[model samples]
Target: MFNMSGLDLMVIFKLAGIGLGTTLINQLLKKTDAGEWVFYTTTMGIIFGLLIVLQYVLQFFEAVQTMFTF
Candidate 1:
């Protein structure tokens, strides 16, 4: 029951966008001498990305549990 949808592509794009955004901001902050903020920004980015995938991961596990339960 693997049905791919437009949302899957969007999620991938969103993750890619976050990665690019973080890299650019990291470089900009490094150049501007705002090194202290870099850690927070990168951590936030990782958190956001994880959040974006958490739902799907949970759903996948739930589906597996249900499939095997019955």
Candidate 2:
């Protein structure tokens, strides 16, 4: 029993978008020789994406607990 609601789809899309944007920005920074910023950009993107997924993971655990009355 998996939940695949619109909100979940949106979250997945958001993560993908963040990954793509981060890659593009990193490439641009590398081209301009701003190598230091590329790392920070990627780290921030990953952190933000993790936070988003973490919220859903918490919600999923809550749902499971409620379903099984654990």
Candidate 3:
């Protein structure tokens, strides 16, 4: 009873990639002495990822409203 279109899968993959990349970058920065930048990097990554998902979330709500409306 679940539907996942190609676009949805792509967004999921994109989020996964962002998480992986951010983790790697954070580790690299921590090893170097740029620990301060790690927090910003992680925060930006989360914000970016949420922005990517937000579009779909809004669309889902719109779809539900449309489906329930006469």
Which structure among the candidates has the greatest lDDT? 2
Looking at candidate 1, what is the lDDT of residue 57? 78
Cα RMSD for candidates in order: 2.1, 2.6, 3.0
**lDDT against the true structure, each candidate:** 0.86, 0.87, 0.86
Task: Supply the TM-score for candidate 1.
Answer: 0.84
Which sections of candidate 3 miss by over 4 Å?
Answer: 1-4
Candidate 1 global CA lDDT score: 0.86
Residues 1-70, model 1: lDDT tens digits: 3234635688999999999999999999999999999999999999999998887777778768878995
Q: Pick the candidate with the highest TM-score.
A: 1
**Which whole-number lDDT from 0 to 100 does residue 28 have in model 3?**
99
Q: Name the 10 consecutive residues with the lowest summed lDDT in model 3.
A: 1-10
Q: What is the lDDT of residue 45 in candidate 2?
A: 93
User: Once superposed on the true structure, which residue ranges of model 1 sit more than 4 Å away at CA?
Assistant: 1-3
For each of the candidates, give the backbone clash count. Answer: 0, 0, 0
Give lDDT for model 3. 0.86
What TM-score against the true fold does each predicted structure earn? 0.84, 0.80, 0.83
- Worst lDDT window (10 residues) for model 2? 1-10
Residue lDDT tens for model 2, 1-70: 3365746568878999999999999999999999989889999999999998888788788778889984
